[model samples]
Target: MSTPARRTGRPRSAEADRAILGATRAALVELGWGKLTMGDVAARAGVAKTTLYRRWAGKNELVVDAVAAVFDEHLEAADHGSLRADIEDVVVRFATLLERPETKTALMAVVSEATHDEALGARVRSAIVDRQKRLVLVGRERAQLRGELPPEEDPAAAARNADLIFDVIAGSVVHRLLVSAEPVDREWARSFATVLLHGLAAASSGTGTAPAPEPAREHRQKPAGSV
Candidate 1:
């Protein structure tokens, strides 16, 4: 006799994936990477430890996935038909994400783990590089399309300016969060964008402006509003 047909059905539940990510983020915030345990994640997720393990190889993998999920959820590329609008949108969204206590805590946890975990470091670098590259490319292309950038304007320089915008914001936020300085909010991001854009536009116009200021130190500090 012929065997019965195998069952065909819809894929896994989206709710479950969200639950796992949510639980993982919560656990990281509460316990941090060193103290976080599979049991804690399972308890927060309201699922069995076996289930959590089945979905992720270990705490590192879970943390990586959680960070990726948070980025995807919060950071969206803005195509506002103009470079300025796009910059504003991205800067605002970035500041908003940094302001989130859960996101900040989770980021610190992942960054701390990356100090010793080579694999985790690679994952973090890949995520950051790819996202930054995408933003720069999109902004540069849009600026070119709008004829805002001069014909002789270097695409690489324009793209690098986009990267610099993020660097400034990240540096300022890190300074506040780690050193207990003033918060890096929307205003700071706007100022960064304004200065960077002014320099790039000046370069394109063939009118040299004052030399840019020296970059700040690499070590991060805690901002006023950080948890």
Candidate 2:
């Protein structure tokens, strides 16, 4: 009789993977890429170094996986009917995510490391670019569907414009995060969205009156003279 084929797949534990990713994010936030070590992650995760190594080839893989997890949880692609709503959703979400101290620290660590590590830079680009592109595509499609964009407008150009809005939102937050040291909240997000929508609408219409102001609420008069 032929010997039974050996099992090829290793049984992996989801719980262990979560712990490892959590540990890796924590380590990156605290120590950054240059100082982070696998041993440090092991200690923080309460897992043996062998267990981590069994799953990831090295620290780079582990860090990349952790960053991916963060993005998956935080950076959602929203479809809110109109392009304006979609842009608002993205800006709001971006602002909210940047306010998280751990997330900010971890992202900064990845960015700093990307300056010197080509592999890490590629990983970062892969993690962020396509996801961002999807958001831009959604915005462009919505604009076309709503007739907000010109019929002759290039989809790629529309997408690029969406990306520009994202750049402003992200740039403003990063500036405050790095310099002013103020935490971004819903109000700030709203303002950013308002500004971005106005700019996009103005660009599309070739008019400055893009983000039409919200109508003022009128106070009701008490029947003739009675207060």
Candidate 3:
């Protein structure tokens, strides 16, 4: 008897990855979350259905990764002089990415599902939110170097601040564009940055000082543990 040929998946290919993700996004915009399927994506991408199955277990996982690829581009920011300028540049780019048909539709679908599915929610946080938060870290470091924001002495506080900053920026933008269905124009980005870095009063009247990180207080070492 002749030995049977072993079935094997196609070797991983960057070209294939690009084709699949691109086709998935395009299909998402056309067929939407409810209608899109792995078979259809493989057909559109011109690859074997097994290829998509090997790469992604299901449509939800694939869709999250596809939309994440769009949101994740904010990681590559160009130097825009002041911290405020950087903030404005990124905000506008972020808003534009959200406005893409596939990004909006896929992201909304996944997020709505994520609310009830813990695993999906965790995937969204790890693959998308956590990765993009590096933007907050980078911007904060630059601001510190330029004396725009005060240096944070407490390591724990620094982490908390970065999380809070990202939450505020991401939350406000998502609400304005997706929830309220308002335009996030350049003017809005500029104004939001001003309010974020400075306070509401400063953004409006230009009088209050920008809130900087509080300086760490000095302790006298507790006089060698004398309580």
Candidate 4:
């Protein structure tokens, strides 16, 4: 008789991962971070508690994974013909994600706790913030290829610039959503994009000031005799 093939244990399910993460987000929205538990997520996901524990150590890791998935779910690499358009598109998408009740609550609660938890803080940086910053680098590289942005002569400066831009865009949106309690709608994103793009264009061209407002046109009767 031929030897029987060896069999491995059951494979993990992608559907389970999605369900667990989705349930985690729902739990965060309904229970907040402090009250959320693996049991609750397991019940919500229709899986056993051991299933969740097998995938993540505890609430922090699971929440971070869930939140990161939310961010990744809607993110798209925009190629909107111009950097300004691309930035605006990304801004709108990010704003949409922040507007969701689950995302807003989970992000703030985790960030607040992470301030005192170094490991959690590092996880937040790696899982979510760093991925968000990648969008900026993508837009910048695309703009450079399209001749909209000049190639950087100094790699360090380029990196710093990218970091700064990421902070501005992400920070502003968060502030609007959480601190200011305002909507980051399309109009607001467009306005923000205009200001950001103009500033960038000015910096790239080494023009610090706003062209002196065209010297007010100097329309002093247009020299009545000199027409």
Using lDDT as the measure, which candidate wins?
Answer: 4
- TM-scores vs. true structure, each candidate: 0.71, 0.71, 0.84, 0.82
Model 3 segments more than 4 A misplaced: 1-10, 206-227
Q: Candidate 2 residues 1-227, lDDT tens each? A: 89999877568888889998998888877787778999999999998899889988888778777867776777766767656667667766766777666677777777777888899888877876545566556665556545555433466865677677556666787787666887666565555555665655455553423554432223222223545
Pairs clashing within candidate 3: none
Ranking by lDDT: 4, 3, 2, 1
Which prediction has more favorable TM-score, 3 or 4?
Answer: 3
Higher-scoring candidate on lDDT, 1 or 4 = 4
Q: State model 3's lDDT.
A: 0.82
| lDDT of candidate 1 over 1-227, digit per residue (tens) | 99999877545667877888888888777776779898998888787898777778888878777777787777877888756667767776766776676777877777888999899888877765456556656665556555555332566876677677566655655666556846556665555455566755655554433343332233223334756
Off by over 4 Å in 4: 1-8, 200-227
Q: Per-prediction count of colliding residue pairs? A: 11, 0, 0, 0
Q: Pick the candidate with the highest TM-score.
A: 3
Task: Give Cα distance to truth, residue 181, candidate 4, Å.
Answer: 0.9
lDDT of each: 0.68, 0.70, 0.82, 0.83
Each prediction's RMSD over C-alphas, in Å, is 11.1, 10.2, 7.6, 11.1
Clashes of 1: 11
